[model samples]
Target: MTDDRCFRIDEMDLDELRDRTRDQTLIDAFSNWIRNFAPHVDEVIAEISAAFANNKLRDGIGLFEATGLDDYASDEELRRLRASDEKLDWKRISTADLSRCYCSPSFFDPQGFVFHLPAFLIAELNDEHPYGFIDRIYRTEEHPEGWRALLTNKQRVAIIAVLELIREHPDYQHELDDIDASLERFRGAQSMG
Candidate 1:
């Protein structure tokens, strides 16, 4: 005997279904990320903070200040930002703002295997905010860091970037057309767990 019960899949708006799914996947991805990162974030921030205090996190990369690109900076204004001797002071935000919040242009490894993360971002991770955070690389490595998680480093970057683009320039077109396929990847991982 078989009993069939029909029910709604979700209360989400169909038009925004993909976006909602993508956000859910990223949020889920954060579950394990926060576990590993929560304890270390503070230590990382302390190191970076100490460096800043010592005037070590100085100078911009090329023409870009250590601040990287500002969320509010328009494309034309960004184009004007280039490498030069004139250093732009690091754009420092309060711990509350960075905690459980997303920050752009973050590097994974600043001093070899060591990293400096903003205290604010670390706070958010410890709190496990719904939207989560972004990981920026100040420098690239020839090898992978080997994070054996559902989302790879690049995947996390793409997902976070898409969300940021949606937040910063909702009207602008982006190259995130294949998000559904990516969502399936996350969905698969979730089911396994």
Candidate 2:
């Protein structure tokens, strides 16, 4: 692979993220967002795990019910992924794993949803992928709290950039209204928080 193809998202700083996300394809932009938030995976997993540890409610996505897992993952991989006690190693996660994980966004906890969002965005952006899960991002029943709270400022901006790109793409013109509404909500939420 070439250097750009081999680039690791965790190694990028804010300026690199900004530069990379600008004028990129949707999948590339989503990859940048994944890289931007890659460093936080472990901490996010820890926080969510701690917050829900004592509660009766389950936290994060269950490996068994995740559609991607059922369709693409092996039983051994599922066994390994089910261990939430270990920190999430986003880099080690395969595209098939991402595909599986992304298929079950509705089952993810609000805070934990960030864990698999990059995958969902990537699958949506990539025409090669079989499934479509982008609609879940804006559906009230799936992410009722809105995406603003789940992202850091940079991450939010990156997403907005992707949404904007989607708006301009002819194939995705139908999503324009939802994209506009989400952008408005994100911008408004940013100002309030």
Which candidate gets the maximum lDDT versus the true structure? 2
TM values, all candidates = 0.25, 0.53
Clashes of 1: 13
Candidate 1 yields a Cα-based lDDT of 0.32
Model 2, span 1-193: residue lDDT tens = 1123211233344346456556446445445545554444344434433332332213555433354354666776655555542235332345675554544555555544565555445544543234555565544343635434756655555556555555554334567777788778767766665
**In model 2, where do residues sit more than 4 Å from their true spots?**
1-59, 62-81, 84-86, 140-147
TM-score of 1: 0.25
Clashing pairs for model 2 are 68-100
Where model 1 places Cα greater than 4 Å from the true spot, the runs are 1-48, 55-76, 79-91, 95-103, 106-116, 119-121, 125-193
Candidate 1 on 1-193: residue-level lDDT in tens?
0011001112232224444456664444333333443334445445434443322233223223223353455655554543321232332434443332233324222321122233333333334322333222211221124221423343344333333322222221232343333444434544554
Residue 4 in candidate 2, Cα distance off native in Å: 23
